[model samples]
Target: MNVYLGLGTNLGDKEQNLCRAVQKIEERIGKIVSLSAFYATAPWGFQSDNSFLNAAVCVETSLPPYEVLKETQQIERRMGRNYKSVGGQYKDRVIDIDLLLFGDIVMNEADLVLPHPLMTERRFVMEPLAEIAPDLVHPVLGQTMKELNA
Candidate 1:
């Protein structure tokens, strides 16, 4: 399965955090097929003193969605992610790795959601994602990443 992931960091060696997280993902998860350039953006959904450096990557994995989520969380913890979002508001963090797509699968559960619910609303995610996957369709929205960004 081809999985798309969104990565971001706003604290503690931002570039290094992104790179390390990608390395960990490759080491523990599966092969990385494509990666997008890093993009700097203002923090979304909350106030923050530091802006974020965000990027996206496409990985080919055989693990199921839940297993992929588990591995991603483990990677985040390994990279010093210590706090979860409060009141659905974002905050500065060492690293944030979001699973954006899993081969056109759509899932919604208490702990995870495929085709991330808020991806279209955030330029940080859409921009990097569009760069690497402009024609990748959202399984639910029925639109390409480039169209969504437009």
Candidate 2:
């Protein structure tokens, strides 16, 4: 399966954090096919003094969606990411790895959602995603990442 992931970091050696996370992903999950240029964006759905550095990655994984999510979460934990929120607020973190898309599969479970629920609204995700996968259409929205980025 071809998976697209959104990587963001606002705390600690931002670029290195992303590089290390991608390295770990390749080592544990699967091979990385492509990676987008890094982008800096303001925090969405919350406030934070540290702006987030975000990028998109495409990896070919044999693991199923749920397994992908599990491995990615483990990667985050290994990267020193902690659930940093106070009273339901998002905060700066060492790393955040979000599963943006998994092939054309659309799923909604308590623990996971495919095509990511908020990728369209967040330029941080769309921009980098478009960079790498401009023609990859969202199964739910039926639009290409380039269109969504617009």
Candidate 3:
């Protein structure tokens, strides 16, 4: 399976945090096929003095979607993230690894959502995603990443 992931950090050594997360993902998830350049952006949802360093990654993995989510969450926790954003309230963190897309699958389980629910709406995600997978289409939206990014 080909999966897309969005990585971000603002609470620590931002570049190192992203690099470490990418390394761990390769170790735990699968081989990374494509990776975008790091982008620095302001916080999205909530007020934060710390800006974010974000990037997107495409990976080839044999793990199922749920397993991918589990591993990503574990990666976040191991990297010093204490909790996930609740009720759409975001915060600055050491690392955030979001499972953006799992192949062309569309799922809305309580714990996971494929073609990530808010991916298209966030420039931080779409910009990097488009950079690496410009022609990749969103199964639900039926548009290419580059188009969506526009």
Candidate 4:
């Protein structure tokens, strides 16, 4: 399966954090097919003095969506992230790995959501995603990444 992931960090060595996360993803998940340039962005939902350095990645993996989520979460935990933003409460962290898309699958389980619910609305995600997968379409929105980014 081809999956898209959004990586961001507003704490510690931002560049190294992203690099390590990408490396771990390749080692534990799958080969990285595409990676966007790192982008500097502000905190999205919560106020923070730290600004985030964000990027997007496309990986080809044999693992199912749920497994992908589990691995990504584990990656975050191993990298010093204490908790995920819950109930729309965001925070600065050492690393955040969001599973943006899992092929064309649309799912709404309590733990995972494919074609990430807020991906299109966030420039931090769409800009990098559009960079690497301009023509990739959102299964739920029926719009290409390029279009969404615009």
lDDT string, candidate 2, 111-130, tens digits? 78887988898899999999
Give RMSD (Å) of candidate 3 vs. truth: 0.6
- lDDT per residue for candidate 1 within 71-138, as digits (tens), equals 99898887788777866877789999998999989889988988898899889999999999999999
Q: Which scores better on lDDT, 1 or 3?
A: 3
| Candidate 1, number of clashes | 0
Q: Which model is ahead, 1 or 3, in terms of TM-score?
A: 3
Assess candidate 1 and give its TM-score to the true structure. 0.97
Candidate 2 Cα errors over 4 Å, as ranges: 84-88
Cα RMSD for predicted model 1: 0.9
Candidate 4 residue 111 C-alpha distance from true site, Å: 0.9
Which lDDT tens digits does candidate 4 get at residues 22-141? 999999899999999999998998999999999999999999998899899999999999798889988889999999999999999888878799998899999999999999989998
Model 3 stretches astray by more than 4 angstroms? none
lDDT per residue, candidate 3, 1-150, as tens digits?
899999999987999999999999999999999999999999998999999999999999999998888899999999999799999988889999999998988888888878789998899999999999999989988999999999
Error of 4 at 50 (Å): 0.5
State the local distance difference test value for candidate 1.
0.92
After the best TM-score superposition of candidate 1, give how far the Cα of residue 49 lies from its true spot, in angstroms. 1.2
